[model samples]
Every structure is written in C-alpha cells, then in structure tokens.
Target: MTGQSLLLIDGFNLLSRAHFATSYNRTDDQLKNSKGMYTNALRVFYQKIFNLIRDHRITHLSVVWDVKRDETARRKKYPFYKATRFELPEPLIHQYETCKAASDAIGIHQISLSPYEADDLMGALSKKWSGGDCYIYSNDHDLFQLLSETTSQIIAGKQGEYVYSLSHFQADYGIAPEQWVDVKALLGDSSDNIPGCPGIGEKSALPLIQHYGSLERIYENIEQLEPGLSRLKKKLIQGKETALLSRELSQITCDIAELDPLLMDDLKVSIRKDVLGEWLEQMELKIRIDSYGA
Candidate 1:
C-alpha cells in the first residue's frame, strides 16, 4: 500500500456511465457539439478522469477498452455470452472513439487487445503491477476476484465513490476473493447472460462456496452433503457442466502475455497540458482544462 498507486480504468464502462450521467432529460442534439458530434459523454469522461486522478493521487494510469463484441474470446466460446445486453447508442459510440483519441492526446496509456476484455486487461495489469498499490476503476462485481493486499476496485456509487479492498470483500462476502467466481458460477449473472447452476442463487451459492471452497470441491463432496441440503446438492449435480462453464466465463484472465511486457513506468501519468487543452477545445467540451493541472 506504500508504493505508487496505479489506476486502471475500464474505458467503455466509464464512458457509458458518463453518457447516462449527462444525457438525462437531454436530447441527442442538445448533447452534440456545433459540428453535430456528441460531446456530453466525452466531457464527463475527462471530468471523471481528472477527478479520479486528483482524488486518488494516481501516479500511474491506463484506460482499457474492449474489442468488438463478436471478436471477444468469450463470445466465440459461448455465442450467447452478453447477447442480452443492448447495443451501444449511436451518440455514445461516437463519444467512445473520441474519448480514446482524447486520452491518447493527453498521453494516457490506452490498451485494447483482441479476444480479451477491459476486465481482462485490468486484471493482467493489476497482476503485473502487484508490487505496488493498484486500483481497478470499474463497477463490475466480477472484478472482485482480483482484489488482494495490493489491489482494490473503485466503484462509482449512488452516494459517492466506494473503494472495495481485500478486507472489504472478506467482510462483505465472508469468502476469499478467489472464490467469487465460484459463487457467481452457482448464482449466475443475468445481465451478462451467464446461466449459472439451475435453481441456485446467492442463498445457496454463498454457503456452498464458503463451506466447500470451490466448485470442484463442492462436487468432490457432493454425496457427503448433509441430508438437509439434498435439494441443493441435487441441483449442483445436475448443473455441473453449466456451473463449470459459468466459472470459466466469470473468471478474469490475469496473465495476458501481451500485457506482461508492459511495465509500471510505461503507465505513469504524464499529461501534456498543451495537447489536452487543444484537444478539449477541438472537441468543444466545457471541461475546465485548468483543473487537470497536468
């Protein structure tokens, strides 16, 4: 916790949040610049970045993006993965690309690898920067598995920003961070279209993972489970394959080989005030360029 802290952002996640935050009660035209391009999300995106850097005293920063949805490894493995989620709005899509360009103009490291997600990139980077205090800026609960003594997750909550640490995970879930995938495997995530164990949810998943430690262990001792939990045991037995697949989908890849060569020094924040001011002016964003204090 004493070393320099690195802030790894899930780019699209933050952009989507910014879009909703600024788009409320506003039409597409109202959110657009004079050139007919969207600026609301882009404005809020930079504002959040500036705020996060100032608030966290972030020494190193990186913005991670997801490749095309169809090109993702998860979608290739399970065609139905994330199929339920709606497509990004046209305005948001425009702003997303602008945000990436703006991030680069300001000298922030932007990462996007084929077949992997922002979550995976953040996981890989967090693992690579394990020597220091690394913070994953995202609202995705699935990233909880990456929590450790040196890594935490920053979530933008309704009240304010909440930082979830290893201790917080332990206190809230009463299970190891590594066991989160197992819990999700049993409980399922409707948002992501991950069909977890049938007839199983938090009520059953939590105790099963807390008691057995893992999905495999639960199955190893399946027959020995108490008679009072016979129904839950039966559900696990029937959903074994699904649960295994769900675990695979829920788990974040923390060792992307391409990210291995990326050193912490490469991510050190070195914003070019001149470039940022010019980019903001070009985008017609109303953000206070002076607040960045690059």
Candidate 2:
C-alpha cells in the first residue's frame, strides 16, 4: 500500500479504446484479413504497457476485468447504469479477447469474478500490495476513491497510455483524488448515469463539501448553505436517497468477500522473451528491441 508498484489494468478499458482507435484508422474487413497488419495496434499498446511495468519494476501485476455486467451490486442500485457501453464493434471486440489470450501466454495474470468490476478487483488487490506506489491503468474516475488508502491514479486521456499519479490526478481535477466520490456525488456522472444535485458542478461542490466534509453533513445542515446552494439543496433533498445510493454505486469496492490475493502465487513473474517473441510474430507487431532484446 505504501511503496509497492503493482500494475492493475482495466482489461476491457484498454481493449475498447484500442478497438475504437484501431477502427478509425482501418476498416474492419481489412484489419481481420490483413497480413496481421492490424494486430500491431494491439501489440504496440500492450508493449507500451508492458514497458511501463518494466520501467516501474512492479512487485505485482494483475489485469482486472468485468466478467459480466449483471452483478447484484450494480443491478440493485441502478439497472440501466452502463447499459449501452456493452455494445462494441466486432473487430475491436475480437481484439479485446485476443489481448486477454496474449496476456495469459505472456504469464501476466488476468482477474475477474462474478458480479465484481475490474475497478473493484483492483481496489481489493491494491490493499494487499506492500510497499511502493500502486497504480490503476484506467481512465475510470471511480478509482479515485482508492487514493485515500493507496497511492492511486488512472491511465487517462485519449490514448490512455499515460499514467496519472496521485499528484497528476489532483492537478487535473483541481482537487485531491480522495475527494472524487464527493465531487461525483455533487456533480453526478452522466457516463455511469448517476444523477447528482441538479445545479452543483465542481466549482460549488468543492467548497461546500470541503467546508462541510461530506454530502451527508452538507445535506444535514441544508438550511445554512449559501443562498444559491440553498436553493440547490432542495433538489438534493428530493433525490437524497438516490444520490446516496449512487454515491455507493459509484465508489469502487475494496472489500471483496471471497477473493484473496495471497492465494495468487503468480502475482510476481516476468514476461518471457521466447513467449513474447512468438506472440509478436503471430500478432505481427514491430520489435523495438534488438533480436537479442526479446
């Protein structure tokens, strides 16, 4: 939790983004049938991620996935949340599956459990990471809550290859990562389809939450808020139950009941040169390494 470097990648996140980017540059019919020409995109992205892990010299590595979206946790909260993102183009969708296979062949572990998301899996595993900084390779803002307990950040922006450390998250958001849930609760998440206080955006949310320390507290003293915010508080009161429920739904769960990282002995391993070479050959990716570099 303190000084460890563990790479927790959101497998589908990388795959979907790669697919969309790959599709933009190449037509689907061409990519699947080409001389493994299109596989390079997936390879290059994985290679970059692999190199980042190598450069950081992580003690543990795990790729997290949302196996199926039909979890009791999510369905119980808001049935329609993330309903549409499930559909993805065929070429990139296939590539996402291939990437999982490639990761396995390379000895990197991919983790998924029933009803839990990759973010939650990372959060739980991150708690067990000992020493150094733990990183999550996702652009998902939900992960920011874990920053309170572990060194947390997301792989963000268009390419999503850039790693955002704790400081980088704060710099980008105008508030610390720990305050992310509060921020989301106030501003609401259209992506996740969680509704927040109708009028509260980042500007007003930060000061009110910072002053009061939590949404619950601010709501408890709704009468004393700034005149503008006071009017907005009425909206929060109406949706109070839903807002709190959304807050719970939005935060990544670090306490998974059944899964234990201690059982995973393959957590520490290096990617083999022969395996990497064979996969690259099959995928037809370029080698930045010399023939000897693997």
Candidate 3:
C-alpha cells in the first residue's frame, strides 16, 4: 500500500474486448500491417497499457494472459467450465505471439502460464509482489474479488473509468469485497459456465451471505432461518451440494509459482524507442511507431 504503484493488465480480457469492439466497425479493417497480422487488438492493447502507465504514474507493471482453454485447471475440475464458450477468432489467435513480442519490445513484463487463466495469475502476482498500491486493468467482474486495501480493478470505457475499490465494492454490492466469490457462487456466472443453485439469485443469496458471512455458515444455520421462508429454505437445502461446488468454481486461485526471474527484472517500465520502432514497423503499425517519439 506504500511506495510505487503496480499495474497488472488482464491481457486476454483487454485484447478480446478491443477486438470485439473493432470487429463490427465497417470503416476500419481491423488494422493490418504489410505482414497481414491482425493489428487492431495489439494496437489497442499497447495504446491502453501505455495510457494507463502514463495516466496512473505506474512504477511497476505486468500483463498476464490465459493459456490454452483445454489446459486450464478449472476445466479439469468441471468439464463444463467455459465449455459453452466459443473459440476465439483465428485472426485474434494469430496475433497472440505478436502481442507478446510487442509487449517485450516496449519493455513491459508479460507472463503467460500454461493450465491457468490470467485471473489466477494476476491474483497470485498481486498477492506476492504488490508491495505498494496495485491496480488491475480488466473488465471482468470476477476480478473484483481480488480487491483489497492496496489493490483495485479498473475498467476504462466510453462513459469514463470504473474503479472497483473496497469502498466502491461495498457501496455497489452491499457486502465486503472478500464476499464476492460467495455472491457469485449463489447466483452463478453463466459467462464462465458455473451453475449456481437453480432459481436462486442475488436477491435470495445476498441477505443470507450478509447475515451468515459465508455459504458454509448459511448452510450450517439453515434450520434456524426465519420460518416465513419455507420455500426458500427448501431450495437452499436441496441445492446445498451444487452451491458448495459452485463456490469452489467461483474462487480464484492465488498459489501460482513466481514469474520468471527475467520477466521479474523486466517489470519496470522503460521503453527503448528504437527497438519498439522496429517491432512496430515489422507489425505494420506505422501509426503507432510514428507517434512513439511524440
């Protein structure tokens, strides 16, 4: 919570958001260089990361990306986890390597772990290395659970930036930041294919979590819950097993091994304009390269 600020970007989340935003734009052809690499997502990603560093006076930064879908541990735990999700477009997939190279060229620390998603890596990195103020750049509400006294998640949008600090979380969700996983467990996250107790929702689950502190405590004291809620009590009792499993699916793991020593050394933001210019030129991102020295 002291000294310099560390900014972590959820690389896949940001890139996907950018790619989709530009995909339907009829005027722009998703920016391509002479090599035919899809440059739209990478351009947006780099621009946004640079803007964040400059705007926030970031001293340390890292971009974490998700590995292959089939390799994720969550998928192993529940075969249906993100099973319904569509595959990323081939063009976007093609840009993944270039994006990593661009990040390195611009002197950004980048980490991609096999069998783990960016959220889990970001969680682990923030917990282990964020000795100062830490800001997570992503649009995923799932990352809200990572909020702490020194850590917050941000989304930059047309309407302005949305920051999920501990206070903002409390005001918006009526529960402590730490209770986010429990809330998600009760309502389920369709985006990630986690099915909460059938027909149960935030309205039904929030009050119980608020009163009992957790899903575990709520189940323990279910019998003592008010008598007027007989139907609700029955639903909770019936959905007990699923709710517990959902809780496990909702939580983000933070026990990842430390990043590579070389990447750790690269965490400081320092740009070599010439090296970056060569990368931008190869990628056909002349516009970005032209603006670099400006």
Count steric clashes of candidate 1.
0
Write the candidate numbers in order of decreasing TM-score: 1, 3, 2
State every prediction's TM-score relative to the real structure. Answer: 0.95, 0.85, 0.90
lDDT of prediction 3:
0.78
Please tell me which predicted candidate would have the highest TM-score against the true structure: 1
The number of clashing residue pairs in each candidate reads 0, 4, 0
Q: Which residues of candidate 2, in runs, are more than 4 Å off?
A: 1-4, 33-41, 148-150, 158-163, 167-178, 261-265, 289-294
lDDT of 1 by residue, 1-294 (tens): 465789999999999988998899998799998989889888888888888888878888999999999999999989999999998899899888777777777898899999998889888888888447888899999999999998999998889998999999999999999899999999889999999999997788898888889999889999898565567877888999999999999999988888667777888889888898888788787777656444
RMSD of each: 1.6, 3.3, 2.7
Q: Give the TM-score of candidate 1.
A: 0.95
Worst 10 residues of 2 by lDDT: 285-294
* lDDT string, candidate 2, 180-206, tens digits: 787777777877677776766677777
* Local distance difference test scores for all models: 0.87, 0.69, 0.78
Q: What does the lDDT read for residue 136 in candidate 1?
A: 89
Q: Judge candidate 1 against the unseen true structure and give its global Cα lDDT, from 0 to 1.
A: 0.87
Looking at model 2, residue 21 earns an lDDT score of 62
